[model samples]
Target: MSGYPDNPSGHMSGSARTRRADAQRNRERILQAARELVHEPGELKLHTVAKACGIGQGTLYRHFPTREDLLAEVYRREVEDLVAAAPRLLETHPPLDALAAWFDRVAAYARVKRDIFAAVEAATWQDLAAHSLGPIGAAVELLLAAGRSAGGVRADAEARDVIILISWLSRLDDTELDARGPRLLSILVNGLRAHHRD
Candidate 1:
């Protein structure tokens, strides 16, 4: 609660309160429509997306300002999802398996990106590449640390290295599917294990 806002939401002038509520509703709808399409990154039609969100196309534009802006937001949220899932996986699975499962989730997510999020621009991908790293890196570091403490993960595995490896793994096609992920994660997990220590 340290940084919690005094409002715990947002300040609104009388004239803006109704508009703010409408905006919040539209934003929620947009986020819902955008969530499943986060990874695909292609075929995210704003007009159709608006319909899916139960809002008008104009409202979508009004809220998002532009397509690129919407895409950026959706990208940020997707990264958040991946990061958020880490703790849930750790809570439910054994350490190494949790790590492996998370890898599998991410690898599959790459396929989703191509269909929903649209063509990846060098600039956009660059932005995504840069911003997406921090949360995931932290999550992986935590997972590896947990695994290590549990005596299942290798000691020498660094979070930065893990992030790099996962970045490479994320570009794989659906044909590669779960095959490469589990195997690669196994080796990585072995490297993270205190016993292997390499």
Candidate 2:
């Protein structure tokens, strides 16, 4: 046999890897709990999250030093999920349809932002806002380019314009928004559509 440790399970096998995997699982559980709790005013208490996660305070703190840190990570992960949806939307629908679907997703994201805005205020919301739009802008540009190429959207459209239109949806009161947001967004999408050619 070789001089290396006689392990039948490959070159590495031990509790260290198990501990790391457990840590990762705990981290995800903590974030999920945070996401749910952030929607409730003053409910983002870390102890609550730890209790929900069934982990010690030390484990939660190991993943996030402060409530603000946890909030920022949660928001960042939410934005990442939004960005990741673009390709999946495109795969399932035509360009314009995909863009429309993505607009709906954006509306949902904006609602979440409004819900969590109070908690996020204590964190680096400005810095997060500054950088978060880049991924969204790029995703919008991709969708718009595809729409124009497919002759489904106006050639003159820019991602900034759509972003501006969508931003308005986030500002409305939740009730009014719930009542009219879809109609307003439909109009916006309809306006963006390319005129039918002969």
Candidate 3:
């Protein structure tokens, strides 16, 4: 018998496994570096990202293929993280608390989106719209429904309103946002709360 066992699927080889692990690590490093740098001044440069990740331009290009691809992937990951947090938050907190906490996360997501739009000015409305608000809308709907059922929120509150309110954060400066975000968010949460039962 040969030193290596018969592996038809090809991934069972030790060298293949090592390469896969290395690729995953490199991919993570590239993404982390991009996240750190994309928010800074000026446009994003692939070389800078590669240098920060300690990887060659060839490797970065191999993984992302294009700058738009990289930006889209990053944006998708951000939305996915936000959408995934909804269920976890609901499980851990009461309905109203969960809704309030989700708004905080939405603010953070808006910040990330602002940086992304700044860095990739040509990322097109269609490119953005392709991400589809379905997941986030569903998350907000779940929270709103829970809040209403628990008698914590107004019966007329809509999920789209929460999204629109949180989106306003994208228009504020970092300094002003830091100063006013809490109060503004408090107003928003209070507005959503039930003042009188119908």
Candidate 4:
């Protein structure tokens, strides 16, 4: 027999596992860099993203073949994170506080999305919005359900209505959002309260 160790099972060897880990690290670095740079003032170029992440262009291209691909992944990951926060927040905080915190997350997401949508093609933006709507709405519903059960939120508060109420966040400029986001969010949250006066 050859000097190499025999492997009957299909599990990845140590070297293969290391390579996979390295690839995942590189991908995450790229995404993190892209997320930051996308908010900057100029056009987001692939080379700039690769450089910011300390990865070579070829490596970046291997992970994301086009700028649209990278942008789409970033947007999708943002939505995933936003959706995943609902359950975790509910587990840790009171229903009303969790709902308030989730709204904060939504405001952050809207900022990033507004910048990203400006960079991507209209078709890409449309596709991303279509795919994200259901999961995001569901996340809102989850938070609202918890609040309603706790008697902190109105039983009649619908996810779509909440969505519509917050949609204007995307239209605010960065300065305006910074100055007004918290107050606006507080108003929105209080409006959903079970005991709020008309």
| Stretches of model 3 off by over 4 angstroms after superposition | 1-6, 9-11, 121-125
Worst 10 residues of 1 by lDDT: 111-120
| lDDT assessment of candidate 2 | 0.85
What number of backbone clashes does candidate 1 have, counting pairs of residues 3 or more apart or in separate chains? 17
| Residue-wise C-alpha lDDT for candidate 1, range 88-129, written one tens digit per residue | 999999988888888777765555544333454568867776
Quick one: ranking by TM-score, best first? 4, 3, 2, 1
Candidates 3 and 4, the one with greater lDDT: 4
Q: Where in model 4 is the C-alpha error above 4 Å?
A: 1-7, 196-198
Question: Which one wins by lDDT: 1 or 4?
Answer: 4
Residue 136 lDDT in candidate 4: 94
State the lDDT of candidate 2 residue by residue for 107-176, as single tens digits: 7788766655556664478787778889988988989999999999999999999888887776777788
**Candidate 1: what lDDT?**
0.72
Better of 1 and 2 by TM-score: 2
Q: Compared to the true structure, candidate 4 yields what TM-score? A: 0.94
**Tens-place lDDT digits, model 4, residues 24-105:** 9999999989999999998899999999988899999999999999999999999999999999999999999999999999
Root-mean-square deviation per candidate: 5.9, 4.2, 3.4, 3.3
Displacement of the residue 122 alpha carbon in candidate 2, Å: 6.6
